[model samples]
Target: GKVPILLPPLPEQKKIAQILSTWDQAITATERLLENSQQRKKGLMQLLLTGKKRLPGFEGEWETRKLKELCAIKTGKKDVNEGNPDGKYPFFTCASEPTGSDEYSYDCEALLIAGNGIIGKTHYFKGKFEAYQRTYILSDFSNAVSVSYLHQFILYWLMRDIDREKQHGAMPYIKLGLLQRFNVFVPSIEEQQRIAMVLSYADQEIDGLEFKLNLLKQEKKALMQQLLTGKRRVNVETEAA
Candidate 1:
């Protein structure tokens, strides 16, 4: 059986199409801007996090330190099943977004690293939260390094570390020893904070663009619903007879 399709009058259809085209163009432009903003942030991360591009009036030698020296690392005792949607605390699993849990495990600013699935994926949170058994928590950061800075550094370097592990014939996953031995280049605390702040500003811009893109898409969808159905009529101008 063939399905019947309802179409508007030729002029009205053309007008609707034209209106939708405008929205399409806007969506495409916003998508391009979002991509460019993300690329800009990635470039900034590569330069600033590596110390190759120093911010104004900050000049000093960067020291290298092992992960163990910078913070205490441990795995969470809770499992994925422990997460509760209505719980009080954020329950972190290997996934990107945290679920909820009533119980509190750790209370500090730390980096949550996915140990297995989505390996090397990291989340930075500065409050009380629970974690999955496979989630590695790095807390009690040394005064020499800012936890925010370390979070940014790990995000920049973690992928490379994973690739290196693959090159060494090991499975792609975060091990306790890997965290203990990973090397981080340390700049002064003040410089670290400055770099993190700049990168964060870049993040905020990207987020705002994303929110705009979503809104544009949603608006376009609503327009399509109205125009395609008989719910809303289009005004198509006619030529003089």
Candidate 2:
């Protein structure tokens, strides 16, 4: 038995191919922009968060304080199995993204750090949310510290510190004591806010680039389906004239 194939006229086929090729180029350019933006943010975080490069009009020695001095640290009561996909609030575990949950145990501006598995991974959330038993929540920030700045600081430093703690033959994990004793370089709240704002702008740029990339890819996919299946036909003769 011979299979039937739906093929368009040569002129129409060429027009469709040209349209898809343009989409491909746009998607590739957006992907490279997204990558470059991410790397730029990473570099900015290292410099501004560490006080190695100061923003204009700010000059002073930063204070070094232990984590316990800046905020209260505690763990969540819920287990990983308790998450609900259709629930109302965020359920944070040791993973990268939060799942949905019906119940929330804490309500505040807080930083959540994974205590085990993927040790040192951190998330900052404000408002009501549930958390896994092993996730460390840092809240009740001191007046002198900016929680936003602290979150950025931990994002850059804690993971690097955790990497050094990984022993030969042992699974890496974070202990309460390690967090309690962890040191942070604290600038005045004003300087902290300034640095955090610059980094936040960089994040927004990266996000915009990523959204554009997704839209381009999706448009190309839908166009391919329509053209290849003959659901949409190109008017090659009109375009040529």
lDDT score, candidate 2, position 197: 87
Off by over 4 Å in 2: 1-6, 116-119, 162-171, 239-241
Clashes by residue pair, model 1: none
**Total backbone clashes of model 1?**
0
TM-score computed on alpha carbons, candidate 1: 0.90
Kindly list the per-residue Cα lDDT of model 2 for residues 1-241, writing each as its tens digit. 5988777888887898898999999999999999999999899998997888999999999999999999999999999999997889999899878888999999999999999877888989999999999999999999989887888889888877877667553446788998999999999999999988888899899989989999999999999998888988878978631
Task: Report the lDDT tens digits of candidate 1 across residue range 149-202.
Answer: 898899889778797877987856678988899899999999999999999999
User: Where in model 1 is the C-alpha error above 4 Å?
Assistant: 163-171, 238-241
Residue 196 Cα positional deviation in candidate 1, in Å, after optimal superposition: 1.1
Give all candidates' CA lDDT scores: 0.89, 0.89
Q: How high is each candidate's TM-score?
A: 0.90, 0.87
